[model samples]
Every structure is written in C-alpha cells, then in structure tokens.
Target: MIPIALAPASPPERSAWRRHRFLLLRRSSQLAVLALFLLGPWAGLWWVKGNLASSLSFGVLPLTDPFVLAQSLAAQHWAEATALIGAALVLAFYGLLVGRAYCGWVCPVNAVTDAAGWLRRRFKLNAGSAPPRGLRYALLAAVLLAAAITGLPVWESVNPVTLTQRALIFGGSVAWAAVVAVFLFDLAVAPRGWCGHVCPMGAAYSLIGSKPLLRVSAAHRSRCNDCGDCYAVCPEPQILVAPLKGKAGSGPLIQARECSACGRCVDVCSTEVFQFTHRFDHRRD
Candidate 1:
C-alpha cells in the first residue's frame, strides 16, 4: 500500500499550478477527445463520426484502431480500402512519434482507472497481489488467436474502454456494468491492473510504437531526492527505475515501450527531475 505521505508536496519554490501542469494538460486532452465524440450525439455537431474502432474526422480524414483491423484480417475478413488507409495513418502517427501515448492522453477509460487508483491510494487500500506484467502480452496474443478461431473481434464485446464511452453516451446497463467492473477491479483487486497488467489494447499500442522518438527523460536525475512522489503517481512505475537512477548506463531517456509517455513523474517531482524529450537526447546533469 502507498502511504498518503508519498503524495506530492508542492515545494515552496514551485507553484501548485506549475507542479500539476502536465497532469492538468493530460486531463484536458482526455476530456477534449471525448467531447469530440460526445458532441455529435449530445449537440448534433458531427466533427468526428464513429467510435474508436473506426472514425472519420470532418468527413475526410479516417482513423481506425489498427488492433481492430488486425483482428478483422486474422478472422479472414478483407478490410475496406478506407480501413487500410485509416490503419496506416494511426500506425504512422503512433509508431513514429509517441508510443502508447493513447493510453495517457486519448483513451477515455484511463480517467476511470486513474480515479480508482486515486481512491485506492487515498484510503491506503491494500491491493491484491498483482498479476505478472507479462500477462498482458500473452493476453494480446490470446485476443488475436481468439479472433482467428471465432471469426469475430471478440475483445470488443467486453472492452472497458469502448463500454465506458458507450455508457457515458448511450447509458446502457451492460456498458455501465463493464465500466464499474473495471473500476472495482482496480480499486479492490489490483492497483492499476486493467491497463498496466491486463489490457491487450495497451499491449498492442506498446508494440505499435515500440521505438517511438518522443519520450520522457530524467534529464536532471542528479536532483532527484528519493521523495517517491513520482513512483507513487506513475501508472507504469517500473519504467522509471533505470532512467531515474542511471542504472547500467541506461542513460537519461525512458525508452521502455510500456511507458505511455504520461508526464505524471514530471508533474509530481519537486526537483523537476523529469521532462519530455526525444529519445535521442542523452544529456544528463
């Protein structure tokens, strides 16, 4: 269990807003993306159409979730031309720029899980033993294998991300149930379990952007005071160790694909030890 004392204490030298700037920005981004989809149904503004499985922006630009496209192909279904184009667009953007950034910035479900994590930490709740991190990769493979055998995008049936968005927009009982299950699982069964150790969608994104150029860097690792604030807040804290400690000459850049490029570490660090940077930046002070 994480102690409440590990929560970030705003250093007198840093304003509270400054300390939480990235966190605020991430929240705003997540809400803005959701608003784009909600606007069509809520207010009849069709700037973006369709769900995360496939979307059209302004009736021109197409964006498809590549993992879903892979499932279609694995099920022996020929993808539409638009789907191919959309998948390519998503792959290029995530593969070259920000790895798994979707998990941090755009995924609506992240907010739900983040809330559960906060409540767990706030109450000093003891989480059940966490499943192996590697379980996610195996689940990713299993999702694909299931798709092949079942001839369906099976994961979508119970995917909390999609269900959470649906519950907010459509208000279905099953959708709300799935969302609650994810929240309860994280709050009681595991801390940050759904995304960090079990989500195949996250696993797919990690592989898609395995070598992304954009990364978080421990540029000022020398200033870190072992305050534990960053680790307490980060969703995938394991990725921070080597870079923050300079272990085995790991350099300053956080190169782990599992890292969602979430800037919680940068936001919570009183010493300002972390920053967003390109992976090529190796400078340390």
Candidate 2:
C-alpha cells in the first residue's frame, strides 16, 4: 500500500496572513487620508477647468464647503440649475448610507487629526474629557447662518480641507499653520478629538445615521468579559464602551456621530463582541 502523508499544520501561516491583511487596511486608510488632503481640492479645480464644473460644484463638494464653483457656474449658465439639485441628492445619499464615515475615513482633515492623536500619545499628554456631542451641531447651525447672512461660504474660513489645500498649493499661510498646529496638539492630547467634537460634516451625518440600515453592532455579548480591549482599540471608545458595559442593554447603539465605521473595534474585540448588522436582524448573544 502506498504510504499516505498528511500535510503539516499551517494555522500559524494562515494567522499571519490574516494579520497582514488587517494591517494593510489600516495603513491604506492612513495613506489615503494624506493623499486626499494634498490632492482633493486640486482635483476639484481640475474638474472645473475641464468643463466638468457641475461635477465639482454639486456632485462632490461638501455642503459646508464654499460654493465658489457654484457661483461661477451661475454666472456662466443661468438655466443649468439641475446640477445643484443632483449634488444635494448625492450628499443626502452619502449621509444615509454611512453617515460621516467619509469624514473620518476619507477626509484629509481627519487624517491630520489622526496624526495629531499619535503625537499626543507619544508624549503622554492628556486631552481631557471629550467635548459635548452637540458642539458640532451648534457649529453647523452657526455656519449655515453665517453663509445665509453673508451670502458667502463661511465654512471656507474654518474648513480643514480648504485650509490644507491652500497651505500646500499657496506655499503656506498663517491659517494653515494654525490649523495644523491645533490638529497636532489635539493629537497629542486626544485621539480623534477633532472629529468627535468639531466637524460639521460629522454633525450632518449623525442626524441621519440612526435610520434602519447596516451598522456596527455588538455581537457575541456573552463572550465579553468586560476586559476593555475593544475600547482601547476603538478610535471612539466612549461611543461603544457604555453599551459594551451592558449599561445600555443589548441593542444597536451608536456612541457618537463621528463613528467612522473603521472596524477597529471589531478587530480588537478579544471575544468577538462586535459585528455589523442591519436594522431588522435580531441581536445574537
């Protein structure tokens, strides 16, 4: 009879592969943030110059962002009003699907904040308690009011995206330096402090995130031993910690509007206590 040989176990090799894949997702997000900060606005400008002004003005521009292109378009095309309407729908769709995950994951400003949080941790600085959850909403209201009253995009003055673009393209300015400094300082003090407290886009997302849809939820709750590993790994730990503690009971809950849906919490959960789920699905123990 021919000798039968079993293949040696490769569990360790498979585990290493999985680890590498996870790291790649994390690192790629960081790199993408840096690229967006440097390239996003210029890309918008290019679209305008290439006769795709509608795409830039309506389809991609954030509502809080300056409508420079929109105003220019108005001057150029008096009857072409559909583009703005189309853009609004797109923005609404984004808000519905994943809330401000775009801001946390894709916005260059958030990337800067992430870097700042790293530097803060390196120095062992304390950022203190997180700001009130309602602050972003207040800021959004103020921005909209200012824009309406002044007939100009007031967000341009404070938008990190615009500031970063101008800093890079125009060889730096005091505003750019100041914003960068705050981002770095916040990083030294608080992890994701900026997104959690101050982003208007985040405020917009939070308003609609509770709608029925697929979202991150706590799974395998009985497996949890309250070790807090998930909290430590979470960018927005406060958002998930209370619920995880069983204080909020077993149900879907979002800890904050700034939750980026990055899956870091899921990755870090030692007992696999978190999973993504739709609104109608029953919570599994």
Q: lDDT values of the candidates?
A: 0.91, 0.57
List, residue by residue over 1-285, the lDDT tens digit for candidate 1.
776656655546888887889878889998898899999999999999998889999999999999999989988899999999999999999999998999999888888888998998899998586789999999989999999999998998988888988998999999999999988989999888989999999999999999998999999998888989899989899999999998997898999999998898988888899999998899999
Off by over 4 Å in 2: 1-83, 127-129, 168-171, 188-191, 252-258
- Candidate 1 positional error at 179, Å: 0.8
TM-score of 2: 0.70
Candidate 1 TM-score, C-alpha based:
0.95
The sequence of per-residue lDDT tens digits that candidate 2 reaches over residues 10-102 is 323235334334335755775654444445455742422111112343245532221333333333533234555654654565556765555
Q: List candidate 1 stretches off by more than 4 Å.
A: 1-12
Q: 280, model 1: CA deviation in Å? A: 0.9
Worst 10 residues of 2 by lDDT: 45-54
Which pairs of residues collide in model 2? Answer: 116-187, 117-187, 120-188, 239-255
lDDT of 1 at 154: 91
